[model samples]
Target: MNGHADVGPLTSLDLRLQWRAAATADLADWAALIARTAAVERPVWFERRADLEQILASKKNPAAANTILGFDPEGVARACGRITRNPEGEKAIGFGCVDPGWQGSGIGTGLLGWMEARTRQRFAADADAGADGGSGAAPRLRLHMEQQHTHQAALFGDAGNRIVRYFNEMHRPLQDGFPEAVLDGGLELVTFGPRLHEPVQLAHNEAFRDHWGSEPRNEEGWGFVVNDPLARPDLSAVVVERASGRVADYQLASHDAGSAESRGYAEGYTDLLGVQREFRGRGVAQALLADAMRRFAAAGMDKASLDVDSETPTGALALYAKMGYVAVSTSMVWDKDL
Candidate 1:
């Protein structure tokens, strides 16, 4: 995407604003800014631009704008946020970040204001054209931030939004090894190979649709995932009916050996765990979690961690609790009306 456009002639903080859609060309600088901020603020893992590009590729195109990069009166890109239409056509905005030097200077507030106006205008125009189908647009917006990020919480709250959910970052020490549990008769747990990738991805996409603020993962998402070199297909576990060749439930685990963020030691992570709706309450989640923990332990990793939306309709908190995963940290969601 192009860099922030010039803010010609205006010098006031509010009047000096200019923004432009982020393009692939800006990925290097954008990723660098994000990486630097992440290192100082969270320092959990390595943030590679390539991985982000892959993830972004899996998503659907935005209705109007994909991302907004903000600039000062001097024409410098310093802040950014993303806006996209969810599966239900609800416009969601998230991943807002401002440079540390520019914090508290009203830049973030300006960006939010711009987003609000843009959101309402787009919704109104769509509504007028009968494109809204008379659904009476709600103009939804969502954001996720670390729990301790009080400044961001204040920013969104001041903008007239409330915390809808608090997601917990859970971790278990993997270097200590995972306990193997014997399954009762007729309840066999199996780890499937690449052959089960599509079915498992579909099951997860369906299960996550009911999740809070989640958009359905399209076929392109599965295609990107199947071709991803980072994904360990053999390390994934899929719950089986034993007699039938059907996948009742599944969970995916990934490892970044060199990055401390992936392993929970200021690096490394084991993320992406989901269970099919039909397979809930049958110990499928636990089985898959345990299997992932085992794989992480075998890899000689120090820790395994993942984030879960505590307000999830699936009672995930209780499930994770039962599996011995505890909260290491938390994040809050911020939102506002245009």
Candidate 2:
């Protein structure tokens, strides 16, 4: 039986399902279980549990009002997920995996249902105290999925949600090398700072404006960048408008040396590649990208990688395609109203 309508024999199954707020004690096992599972399943893009712990450490505190839940019984945590409030006042849910032996069981649905209910309860209680005003309605939840993972997609549809958007992961190999070009249109390429934090951040936010699925950057969003395990403050690049002295484009580069795929491979990643709205047709992005490739190549890297919204309004996917990146893998984002 689906966990939503009834808790079945699986509910009373051998493994007990318990819930608790994430704590220091469970951190290690939590990461291990997730890392091992991801390694076996989606090895290429799996995030180590240590990565989650670091994010949690930065977000958790006594004064903060947010929920990060853990589902586990005894020493094993077969599944994990989170519900967070973004700066835009939106509450979101991100969940993944069930112990292989327990796959057919109701644990996955149970955890998600519990999360939805818990979110409503918390938001409702806050509204009662006059913090948000009116009845506390549950916020919507969203998650990412592999485009080919239809079983997981159906699971959400069965629970009364709908697919929202498709997120694509695009890649390119620097091993094939980059194309050289002479500057045209009188535009100049410049590397501002390993020091201009505020400028780069502002330029990034401006560049992303009007793009599909784009959200404003704030302290919370910036937290994701600043605390990212792959975030290398020194390797970031921003393109400046020589005439106006304004940053018209920017890109952030970083690598995952710990990845098993990178054990002996010479590869780096072009993350957060963005070009400003007014600067689109000017070749600013390509210039910055070419410069970034040169930098990574100079650092002795064989390839560079990045992910793009195949449906981005700016036609970024085609831009990357023309620039020599190829589609290596794909993932989609699914969402439902709560």
Candidate 3:
């Protein structure tokens, strides 16, 4: 995609603001910016170009304006960010980073302001078109930042955002044997496959309905996960009810051995885990997790990781702790009403 027609000037930092829809060509620069920013903020964080590419591809609507890039006078990328609106158009998710060398130079703040403005303008137009189906309520702007990154938290806080929720990145070593998949009668454990996508998607939406700030997953969002190159369909687990033959719970696993952010470790990430409301009391959730962990171990992964809402109503944090997972990092979701 081409850069936005109007290239605004950021005279203070000798940088020009360019609003652009991200393309495959920008993956390398985006990955580099993510790596550099992570190194300076959270050294353990790792991002891959392929991951970014998959996300951009999932947007599907090529005409949607969602990305902004800032460049130095020398044509070098100095900062970048993107805004993603939920299918319901009630929320906008944003994230961006400034070059390590350019921190404290107002570049990061300027980029955030630009993104927020863009989000507001887009949502305003959608509102005028009755895009929200006549809700007429203003959309909320949301952004996530590592709790340890006080500077980022401060920057957003200064802009009137408040911490709305916290999430923990939990990890567990796989050297120990994983628990055997234990399922109650009439529940069968199976691997993810083509026919199970829709059922799994519906179950996921139902499971996350009570989650903070959760939006139902649309077709494009579901496609993004299943179509990801790194997604291990064979390694992912799905628990189905025998009577109705429907997916009750699922665990989607992914791994990229070549990811520089992984720090050379063979890590299997449980991208999404969900259990339908009716299946909560049963052992379906635990069974799906155990089967996933077993698959990761069979793949010779050194560890497994996943993120959970710290205040999940399902007591997920406590459940994970009981399963030998420990918090490795913490992040907060900040929100501002638009």
Models 1 onward score TM values of: 0.79, 0.81, 0.90
Q: How do these models rank on lDDT, best leading?
A: 3, 1, 2
Model 3: lDDT equals 0.76
Query: How many clashes show up in model 3?
Result: 1
lDDT digits (tens) for residues 47-147 of candidate 2: 56556666556542211223233344554666655555442434555565666556657766866675576455455655666644453545666777776
The list of candidate 1 runs beyond 4 A from truth reads 1-18, 43-47, 55-59, 62-64, 71-76, 87-91, 121-136, 182-194, 221-230, 256-270, 312-315
Q: Tell me the spans in candidate 3 whose CA falls farther than 4 Å from its real position.
A: 1-3, 6-21, 43-47, 58-64, 87-89, 259-264
lDDT of 1 by residue, 1-338 (tens): 23334221122124444556666766776676676566556644444676657645644544125566666676665776655443345665655677777788897776666566556655665678766667666776676677666788789888887777778888776655565544445556667577787777777778777777765556775666666556666666777677665667776666665465333353224457776676677777776777777776666656667888877778888877766777888877776655
Instruction: Output the lDDT of residue 276, model 1.
Output: 68
Task: Supply the TM-score for candidate 3.
Answer: 0.90
In TM-score terms, which candidate is top?
3
Q: Would you list the C-alpha lDDT of every candidate in the order shown? A: 0.64, 0.63, 0.76
Q: After superposition, how far is residue 62 of candidate 1 from its true place, in Å?
A: 4.8
Which one wins on lDDT? 3
